[model samples]
Target: MYQLAPNIDLLFTEAGDAPDRVRAAAAAGFNAVEMWGPTGKDIPALKEALEETGVQLTAQLAEPRMQFMIPPKDHAPFYTGLDAGVEVAQQLGCSRIVVGSGTGFGGRKRQDQLDELIEIFTRGVAHIEGSGITLVLEPVNIRVDHPGALLDRTSEAVYVAKGVNSPNFGILYDLYHSTVEGEDVAAELANAGDLVKYVQVADAPGRGEPGSGSIDWPARFADLRNSGYTGPIGLEYYPTIDSAKSVRRIQELVAGR
Candidate 1:
């Protein structure tokens, strides 16, 4: 069975703050959880809860999300944030950090902007070199969720990852975003292969729990296994009902797998 990691930022929210959500995930029989960012989180308390519950954090986002969208775009904060994120990940025993390409730089060629990411993240990786952590660039869909996101296609993310050319750098294949963007799941997975370091899921049309939408979860899961992606799938979706009830469908699917 595939080990599923609930997004503490979205799921188990009724359990209170982020630290409390970690405990809630553990109680729900999930040994792994993921969150957005570690910047403003109560690190000491979060670490304590993880230790107490023995839950492993699957991943967290790099701080100053969408840094490029802001002015100057010197991107220095992104590097500093990467360092801070690595330290937080190390403290919590997490191994992956998710990143995104913000809006394109003014009037620049699309390919140029993408290439710029390759350079920026290459240097960012240098900051965390030998830390045994990975930086996974995420491609978000613009059709529904992010209207101006720079990297919207899996192939684009693959291109950036290849250009970066680091063992510690890869792409995050988000099933929901890909579906919303109308990419073929099997095709993208086949193309990405090992560079697909992390995966996230939410059903399209609503970005809700897996069973709450029209996505063929079982078929998607089959294709995922066929692609040989043996990583924790992050449940990054909004719950339409109680958190536990929202996860029932995923629980059944994971068990059947």
Candidate 2:
């Protein structure tokens, strides 16, 4: 069975700020949680709460998210931002940091842009070497959530990961985004294979909890298992109902109970 880490940014907000959410999730029986940007958050308080609750921090996003395809493409700030993110992750005992390919610039060949990303993160892996943290590149859906984003397909992210080609670098396979983009779960998982280092999930038709949308969780769950991914599944979704009640179906499915 797989472990489920609730995205505290969206899942347990009813509990309070990030620190309090950790306590709430722990009280509710979850042993792990994922969060977004570490900037502007009370790092000391959040760190205290995580230690207190024994709740593992699965991942956090790199700060000042870069729009790489934008003009001039100065990557200095992005590298600094990632370094700062790595510091925060180290403080919190988090193992993974998520990164994204922001909106694409027009008129550039898609291949060139993809290659550019390869260079960006290749340096990112080198820049953060010895941190013992894995950089997980995420491919979000352009169809619904992210319009004009350069990297919207898992295969493309896998390509970037291959280009980076480091033991500590891989792709984050988001189940909801892949489904929204109409990619077959089994095929993409097969395409990604072991390079998929992290995963997140939400239901399609309405990015809600497992039972609230049309996604066949059991089928995808089986496909995910067969694909040989044994990492924790981050429950990254908006709760249409109470947060605690929202996770029941997914908790059951991932637990295979």
Best by lDDT: 2
User: Which run of 10 residues does model 1 get worst, by summed lDDT?
Assistant: 65-74
Backbone collisions counted per model: 0, 0
Model 2 alpha-carbon drift over 4 Å, by segment: none
Worst 10 residues of 2 by lDDT: 248-257
At residue 25, candidate 1 shows an lDDT of: 92
Write down the lDDT that model 2 would get: 0.93
The CA lDDT at 80 in model 2 is 94
Model 1, position 172: C-alpha lDDT score:
95
Return the clash pairs for model 1, or none: none
Total colliding residue pairs, candidate 1: 0
Give lDDT tens digits, candidate 1, residues 88-125: 99999999999999886557788888888898889988
lDDT on C-alpha atoms for all candidate structures: 0.91, 0.93
Model 1 score (lDDT): 0.91
